[model samples]
Target: MLAKRIIPCLDIKNNEVVKGINFEDLKSAGDPVALAKKYDDELADELMFLDITASSEKRKTILKLVEKISENIFIPFSVGGGVSEIEDIHNLLNSGADKVSINTAAVINPEIIDEAAKKFGSSTIVIAIDAKKVGDEYLVFTYGGKKNSGINAIQWAKEVYNRGAGEILLTSMDKDGTKSGYEINLTSMVVRSVKIPVIASGGARDAKDIEEVFVKADAGAALAASIFHYENSGIISIKKYLKSKGINVRL
Candidate 1:
């Protein structure tokens, strides 16, 4: 079996890393390049850089900044936010992104997933789904979690997989930045509904939270921001903890 991955997310805004609770009232976390190097040195499985406001602000991702951060990290890097066209994905990959994640564009035109995957190969495409619980149903949200797409989250997951997306970056808006834990039920539901690997995001406070998601929801990866950004924990230490718990993680 492939070892589970621990990915540290860098939410970028104004070319700087930032973090916010429930995607509101954001604050600076640090420099994206510096943090990328730090996580690389600490043996993080992968790094995800998201231009948190790019879609909402109606701009493309900062390619110059993405290239700069990409230079500092040796591990596989994923870039997302404000990605709308095939050209955008191509440019991000040229800027050194190993994978390009699309959320808003995929929802606005579902055909983009089929087109992108066909052109770029499935492993190069990642579908990011930002979901919120509404009236006993998990609905997809877009534009940096500011608008509800009114699409069922589980159904969307299966659609993306069928459309050839290689993986799903599933984030629960209700649990985002709360640091309480992952939304296990939601994660498990999506995991069961799709064949592609699911990377659980949003509400990871510590190793135990990550372990819970991996064990209970069968997530392929756990992505967190606050815990790693604030130095509350280190990637190596967390991998050590997971290893002690018999969770296979690259050290």
Candidate 2:
């Protein structure tokens, strides 16, 4: 079996790393470059840097910030937020991002998924889905989780995969930053809907929460922020814990 990945996410805003509960009431964490270096040194499987406000602010992702953070980390790094057209993806990749994640833009012009995958290979294209549970179904949100697109998360995941996206970065807005645990039912729905790998995000408090998602939901990866950012638990310890639980992970 392929080793499940443990990823650290850095939510960037105005060139600073930040975290929040339910995607509101943001609090400063630290310098993005510093955080990136720390996570890389800690043996994290991957690093994801998302410009949390770029899409909402109606601007492009900060290339200089991406470049600076990319230089500090040796592991695979994925960059997202405010990425729209093929040119944006090209610029980000050239700026040193191993993968470019499209959320708002992909919802607006999903054709970009096929276009980017064809140009940069599917492995380089990731569709970041920010979803919120509305009644009985999880609906897709865009523009940094400000607007509901009325798109069903499961259907969108399948569409993204069919359109050539290599992976899905699924985040539950309701569960984000709560540190309660991942939304397993929501995550499992998306994972089951797609043939590609699904990286489960939001509300990770400890290793057991991650283990649960991996075991119950069959998530390809578990992405967390606050726990890692605050040093509540490091990647090494988390990996050790997962291995002890008989989860397949790279040591």
Reference-based TM-score of each model = 0.91, 0.90
Clashing residue pairs in candidate 2 (N, C-alpha, C atoms within 3 angstroms):
none
lDDT of 2 by residue, 48-70 (tens): 98876644442344687777767
Error of 2 at 40 (Å): 0.8
- Show where candidate 2 strays beyond 4 Å: 20-29, 53-61
- Candidate 1 TM-score over all chains jointly: 0.91
RMSD of each: 3.9, 4.0
lDDT of 2 at 52: 65
Q: Give the alpha carbon lDDT tens digit for every residue of 123-236 in model 1.
A: 999999999999999999998899989999999999999999999999999999788899999999999998888999989888899999999999999998868644447788
Best by lDDT: 1
